[model samples]
Target: MLAFAAGFIVRPFGSLVFGRLGDMSGRKHTFLITIVLMGLPTFIVGLLPSYATIGMAAPIALIALRLLQGLAVGGEYGGAVTYVAEYSTPSNRGFNTSWIQTTGTGGLLLSLFVILGVRTLTGEEQFASWGWRIPFLFSIALLGVSMWIRLKLKESPEFEKMKVQGTRSKSPLRDTFGNRRNAMTVLLSLLGCTAGLGVVAYTSQFYVQFFLLQTLKVDGRIANEVLAIALVLGLPFYVFFGWLSDRIGRKPVILTGCLLAAVTYFPIYKSIAHYANPQLEHAHTMAPVTVYAPPGECSLQFNPVGTASFTRSCDSAKAALARNAVPYSTVAQPPGTVASIHIGEQVISAVDGKGLSRSQFAAQTAAFDAQVAHALASSGYPATAVPADVNRPMLVLLITILIVYLTMVYSPAAAWLVELFPPQIRYTATSLPYNIGNGWFGGFLPATAFAMVAATGDIYYGLWYPVVVASCTFVIGLVFLPETRFAAAAKISSARASTN
Candidate 1:
């Protein structure tokens, strides 16, 4: 998760740098640079040596490259969306810009197909060792195609008009953030719209991947196949919602999606567990687990940098339970008392590793863990999800519903953002909040949710993170975000009238 978030941390910087360039230069040119920036690092990743070969330098280099990729992506969306919106008719803006939104799902679908193909051709052992690089190396081919398409692209009409009229902002960063009103709009956009959408997007897609593999113990192949099917089934809804936003309003569609996701996430995830791993769910209900620990002994278990040592007995017990995706409740005991896990009729004592040597601690920890595993197995917790028991069709359907919600909130977002900002500083204004929302709010979600789940010892407790974020977005967007559809059309009409 830390590695996954490395790119997100630098996305805003990419937005600012590339966004400023887009506002000053032409959108066509800025994106051309961004495409190369995005592609080269990806290609390099495929070829880069592992830690065994390059020592500590390998990970450091990977992090640096990931940061570059994030920056490129930050700049890419705003330029693409703003360009499309600038060229589109006011009546058709939502539908046109929605096509841009579809690219994400399309790209995901394509990558999944490629990965499956590579995995099949190379075999599991080879794929795990070196075949993974095939996907990353393939990015070079995509880069060439993108570069070709973008090179022939013309400057957006609005940008050309601003250039001819000398109406472009001399200082976009200052105009975007230094001005109080524009800055407030940026903040509202982040909180009320993009932040909510970002969380929903990650929860439905990336977090689901983690939950399936780590929590549900679903097979990697099955999980990927299910997700791919859901994405394919739900792809059309992007266009549907975008078109709907044109008729009704962006605010309504977006807010409705947020509301639906917030209200249904719990049930949807519960249904997923029921279908994906029925045995685990059954075990959870039948042999409910608890940890009895001393007061204030357990740590939060959020090791974002991956450096924290959870050596205390309470911490050890809770961490093991969380790693197994087992839901548990902690009962406070007296100070200095050791922690113990109660799984049905079995009682397993947790060992404190504070004073033991490394080898001694490892031996004790292994014995303790073995005992707990034995208890869990006796209580009917399966080591992995049974392929025969998985309700594949039902899982696909539930996951599709999640993607539909993602599409509803995301499809109209580009058009709405373009309409919100003036052409002079549109790229700069749009990219900042969008990247911040996705990069920070969405990117950090998995790590944050994992920590929450670990701390609480509730398998489903992590879900509250997205539900709360989406709900907040619903309320703030309802009150603050204007209907940009009407406002944008009116602006166009007024501009034409003056020209006439």
Candidate 2:
């Protein structure tokens, strides 16, 4: 958990540092630096030892790499998008920068494909132990290729023009912040534009990937296959929407996507649950379970690292059931009393203790976990989702629709954001809000939603996070966000031209 949080926690700081560099220096130079920075750490992450092998040092090393990756990515997007947007005339800004958006989706698909291919070659059993590193190691070649491509690129014409005209920002930070208008626009961009898009984009991709593996217990192979197919099918829509925005408007397309995600998330996820894990859905209704404990005794079900043991019965019982994806309501029992799990008509008593040795505790917890797993399996709950029973075509369709929502919010985002700020402070002004939205708001979706699901024992409850965020963005964007394609850039250009 701390490691994951570390990845996001450093992004805003990275944006601050690299955004300054991008704005002051050439966009090509700064992003060239960022790409190298990002690629090296990613390559090293593949080589890092696991926790079991190196203890605390392993996680620490991984955390450091993640932070580095965060920093690189934080600065990388702004420069990349700004470079593309500046190269594009107003007529093609949305369409051209939409290709940048495709890289994100395409990169994810590429990585997934490479992983599956590697796993297939290495065989499934060996892949987990040693083969996982191949993809990360392969990033070195990609890094070399990326460096080559970046080397050939020229500084953006717009930025170059501004520099030659003696209109470059002396201090991008001060210029962006000293003025109330830019600050207010940046703030609104966060609340309305990036925040909503972040939630929608991440929830569709990362959260759905998580739901398939962890919640549905679907085989990783099938999930990846399905996702890759959906991505390929839905991938063109990113460019289509971006091109569409040029004709219609950025706000309408983006906001419509947000509203669509907000309204349909519940049913979409519910359908996914039904088609992907039909047995779990049926068993949940047929043999429901409830856990009883003292009101405040149950610990929150969020321990990403396995070091902490939720030894208390209230915590242990819920953890066991939650791991197996068994939905259970918590019942309040007498304070300080031992916990109990009521499965349909059967009641299972939990072992209680005020103090116990570590060995004794582990043994007790292991036994308790086994007991709960047995009870759930016996009550017709699946141990892991069976692939043969799934409605594969329907699952693909649902995930494809989710990807469509992703494209709606993400496709035109770069062009829209680029249009929000001027050539002088564009990199710094836009990067902060964009990174904050994705890094902080979107990055934690899986952990946050999983916690919500664990706490409530309702898998669908987690959808509320994205749904609420997207809905808020819809309303906020409608009111505060400006139409950036035609008027926004002119306004920013005039404002900056006057100031500089």
Candidate 3:
């Protein structure tokens, strides 16, 4: 929570500094620097020691890293978008700028893959303890690669043309905000475009995670896996829809995403809720079971007085018990496996996976009926259980639609925003609005939406926040946003001609 909040707090400042620098110097250089900065901090985070070892310093270091990350990211988007937009032809500005937006989805997908690969390799316990850091550490390699690519790219043609003509604004901030017309244009552009993009981005990506885990009670692992898959599947649509906007016009694509989101939010949430119910029921019915014995054998040890005994090989299970906040023993077993199982606890059970008939299994189990019954009851599995009715496909479909809406709204803004101001103040002007909308509205979405559900006892109410915000944005776009698909170069050209 603290890390996420830090990202929001620091983003606007990053935008200001980087945005100004990008406008003053060159977009390529500024973007490359921000990318390197972002990657290095994330890499450092992967290497940092845990709280158990570092004590109070762990959280402090974590916060510091997150702050750096926020700053780096705040600058990165504006720089990248400006670079793309300045280089792109006005006719294809939306399509070209959309690549900047696609990179964000790519980053998310990359993070997801790293997390999943590490988890799959290490298993849950190990992943929690040490494996979680690998992905962050891996960012060093990614940064190096990204830097290489960025270095090879040229400065934007538009900014170069302005520089050649000596037409760049001396004071970008003053010119941008000092003029009422430009200031209002910036305000209206943010209200119309980025605001909606921010909400859709968070609602689709972040909120879906919350809705699945908190509201529907889906397992975190499953929810993340599902989301990762959906994100990958939906990624191409970001560029595709962006390109479509170039042909059809930006307003239609963005408004379409907003309208679709508004219409689908409730149904998507309901579908997730409905699917997750059965999974939760199944989890309750067929609870997990663990068994413990001596190091090499399944032999049980009894105390001399037959009241308590010590077991040495059960260290793993004991560790598991400790992790779950359950109390257990390295020393003591009450007669059977029944006492071994506890609520919110794990018990080690010895079972052969070899094939056996149902009746044969039942008859065989009768031999240890008391112990088996105790284990079953303790593990929370009833003798008679109903089958679960989980609709995984339906859930996947809904999440896909949600990601599509997010990408549609977000992908076009990168170019659209950069075009709103002159090259000189483009960074500062665009960055402020982008960060506020993305940082405050987008960042707080999950928490705020959850709070709404908590207060109202209805999950769908939270959807209203994004829906209403995007709806207003749709209206704003229709009223205030100009067709900037061909304006950036034109502005520079006009400035140059005036000077000449």
For this target, which candidate reaches the highest lDDT against the unseen true structure?
Answer: 1
- On residues 234-303, what C-alpha lDDT tens digit does candidate 2 reach at each position? 9999999999989887889999999999999999998998999999988888999998888688776655
What local lDDT does model 1 show for residue 461?
Answer: 92
TM-score each candidate.
0.97, 0.94, 0.75
Give the Cα-based TM-score of candidate 2 against the true structure: 0.94
Q: Which candidate is the best by TM-score?
A: 1
Worst 10 residues of 1 by lDDT: 300-309
Per-residue lDDT tens digits of candidate 3, residues 373-471?
555456644332212444567767788889999888887777677776777777778887888889877887776664454333244677898989888
Candidates by lDDT, descending order: 1, 2, 3
Question: What ranges in model 1 sit over 4 Å off?
Answer: 357-366
- Report, for every candidate in turn, its global Cα lDDT versus the true structure: 0.91, 0.87, 0.70
Regions of candidate 3 where Cα sits further than 4 Å from its true position: 278-388, 486-500
Between prediction 1 and prediction 3, which has the larger lDDT? Answer: 1
Clashes of each: 0, 0, 6
TM-score of 3: 0.75
Candidate number that wins on lDDT, 1 or 2: 1
lDDT of 1: 0.91
Tell me the lDDT of candidate 2: 0.87
